[model samples]
Target chain A: MIGRFLAGLKEDKRIWGQRVAGQGVVVPPVGYSETDGSAGGDWVEVKPTGVVTAVARVHRPIPHLHPCAEPFAFVLVKLDGADTALAHVVRDHLEQLRIGSRVEAVWAPDAERHGSIRDIACFRVIS
Target chain B: MSTSGPPKEPVKYVEKQLHLPYCYVAGDYKVRYLAALKDKTILGSKCSRTGKVFVPPIVASPESFAPCDELIPVADRGVVTTFCIVNIPVIGRSIELPYVAASVALDGADISIYALIQECAPADVRMGMRVEAVWKPDGERQGSHEDIIHFRPTGEPDAPLASFMHRL
Candidate 1:
């Protein structure tokens, strides 16, 4: 399931989720429903845009450890069609990032993309 | 309608590296212990009631359950009470394979310290072996355990097993 999901990001610049028996849809599918332990049913493409459900602002960044050197916020974003949220980092406009804030993923350039979570460079506050 | 065949090729592996950087504050006793290392000195705290000494000095002795307030300097040479010949290489260490890792009871210290034994073939490393520390260049010392690269044979006879048997 993870392999298929990574292929989507690397080859198609797309985000995919899976539908489980009890859950509507989960981004970055883990092959099973976390709520009821049921196997995921089908691959579902989710929108790149999402709303910030949670935020953690980091002021003192540890060198070579944190994603960005300057201040940033780690956030949980619920994509348009995904019932669960994806944890990612937001590097810009951290002051504007809060619950219900609109955001969108910023994909890595085609030449620089690899099959990894980092393929999505980061998320940005939309409005 | 029947489902289409599976996708032609699937990703087999996705490589990732995790890096976490952090700082640690060594407590008072450890800070003093590490500071002494730069001068090629080994320090241990002694229990007043039992006179037992422990390296990497602790606040209290487990044996006597008393506070160890006296810091004592122990000899650089000691007896290997127990040891293992390591054949597997560790990821971050550059030591050659088939080296000896041992518990050495430094003179005056009741507790044995974990150290690497080198400068001799693995087959020659044995229980009760007498060894001495091989220190790094004075200028290169960083007040860490690495100040003593490893313990090597001291050309002395093996200590009697009876002398350090309790430490095994």
Candidate 2:
């Protein structure tokens, strides 16, 4: 589930500091739930740098079932400025997966994006 | 039906395929069940209270709602409880046309598992027809239901309807 970052709402406004601090509850990276504007202000886009808060490896080769046909980990990443963890796949460096390992997103090309979470191909471990 | 002079297409149209990957964790019972498939052994979960056995081990007994952890090895041979012939081809279908997708109830099993009944004519697939698992090469086994490539006829007599009637 891609977060609908409301930070674009008047980026030049004076409340940028307060809006940047807005936190949203991402029930589970895949479940969609935008900031209700009650707990915090409109949730805005934050840097993708974060840590893998939870992880699990998939071992099935179901073609259309899940993305990773080869063995890969499904990690929950807690972005630096975000309040909740977002779920995404981590491949290549499976050994780097842990509760607090730093990571970043590797986005898909512009021609491949259909405005969905697939835009972000997969997460890569940095630390 | 459109009563208008002519049908017109919508102004905006777009096609998209949902290609998100999902990693699912098969729970305790499913883990052990699939693990047994690696060795080509069929395991059943027996409900201590009612004594009913399920081929795909259940977390708990359905009849008496008891904790069913005891794993019992069952026969690989069984009878087809029901089946549908694949006359039409579909995308992503690995199997060829005129195949039988039959639900086979293994011996001493209360529930049946769905699988393809092949190596014979689809027209020959009858309800209660005896069948057995055609496991993949031991080297290719990957701890999944796919380990059993497909089921084929055993050339045995069809089981009586009274035997699998309760299952259907």
Candidate 1 structure quality by residue, lDDT tens digits, B104-149? 9998888899999998999999999999999999799999998999
Q: Can you list each candidate's DockQ? A: 0.30, 0.03
Task: Name every residue pair that clashes in candidate 2.
Answer: A29-A87, A67-B21
Off by over 4 Å in 1: A48-78, A87-106, A121-127, B1-10, B38-40, B86-99, B116-125, B134-142, B149-157
Per-residue lDDT of B123 in model 2 = 92
lDDT of the structure predicted as candidate 1: 0.87
lDDT of 2 by residue, A45-106 (tens): 45667888898887775677677679888889887665677778887788767889999877
Please give the TM-score for the first chain of candidate 1: 0.94
Q: Model 1 chain B: which ten-residue window has the lowest total lDDT?
A: B1-10
| lDDT of candidate 1 at residue A56, scale 0 to 100 | 89
Model 2 residue B162 lDDT score: 97
lDDT agreement with native, every candidate: 0.87, 0.71
